[model samples]
Target: MLFSLITMAIVGKLLHNKGYEIEKLIPFVLIAGLVAYFIPIGAIIIWPFKVLFGIIGGILGFVGGIFGSTIGGIGGITGGVVGGIGGLIGGVLSVVFGIIGVILGIIGIAIGLAFGLVGLVLGLVFLFFIPATILFVVIKVLHSETKIAPDRR
Candidate 1:
């Protein structure tokens, strides 16, 4: 459909940068064209629905990401690495454990997310205690010094 092609072209320009491959984009456009050609009315409705849900999902994902990154950016960097490594290991383990290997891959990601959250909380608690602890020690040391070396007039 003409509508699909036009919209897809607009979306491609908006969604992707100059380096984006046309080949990869072709499938998306083709799918959109097919959906438009078959369900023209539905296409109009889908846009608003997609935009609404996308905004909601994007906001929630952003907040969750901040929480995860608070610890050591585990959610941002380590999370991807762990997921990739887990998938690779799981693939290998599949030869021996079958479906359990796939489950392990999912579990690996869950563990990484859990570790990041716990570390973030623990790190915050430690930070709070650190300055207070240092100040207490400094005050104690100064107090002890005054007694040890009395300034007699």
Candidate 2:
């Protein structure tokens, strides 16, 4: 299960980077991961590796963004990369928070852990990684606005 979740996360992310934008599938992946975590189907220790990879990906993206910005006349190049990193962060955060939320939620049910539930939901949203979708849309709008549209007349 752990292996599958990790693979799905990586593959989905790659697809997203390649313009597929498969944000809708994140929640399913995350819920699967959470269930797998409890069922002991995967190495719980592997969780840290997720965070590590996310950090590495983010750093690589930041460097890429730097180069892109320098080469491009405007921030157009970097913004997408930065936004992609942001989306990656969101995915990573979802995994991290989901793990925490599940653990605490199960343990805190008796105590009514609203915080845990809230965190879990927020994590779900992040895991879906919707920000990149929105960011790209915004970037497109801005890019179009900056362009001198040919007059219809």
Model 2, residue 152: distance off in Å is 99
Model 1 residue runs over 4 Å out of place are: 1-102, 143-146, 150-153
> Residues 45-85, candidate 1, lDDT per residue (tens digit)?
79999999999999999998888668667556888898999
TM-scores vs. true structure, each candidate: 0.25, 0.24
- Candidate 1 — worst ten consecutive residues by lDDT sum? 11-20
Q: Give the worst 10-residue stretch by lDDT in candidate 2.
A: 35-44
Show model 2 residue runs off by greater than 4 Å: 1-74, 110-153
Deviation from native of the Cα of residue 25 in model 2, angstroms? 92
For candidate 1, the lDDT comes to: 0.79
Specify the highest-TM-score model's number. 1
Native-referenced Cα lDDT, model 2:
0.76
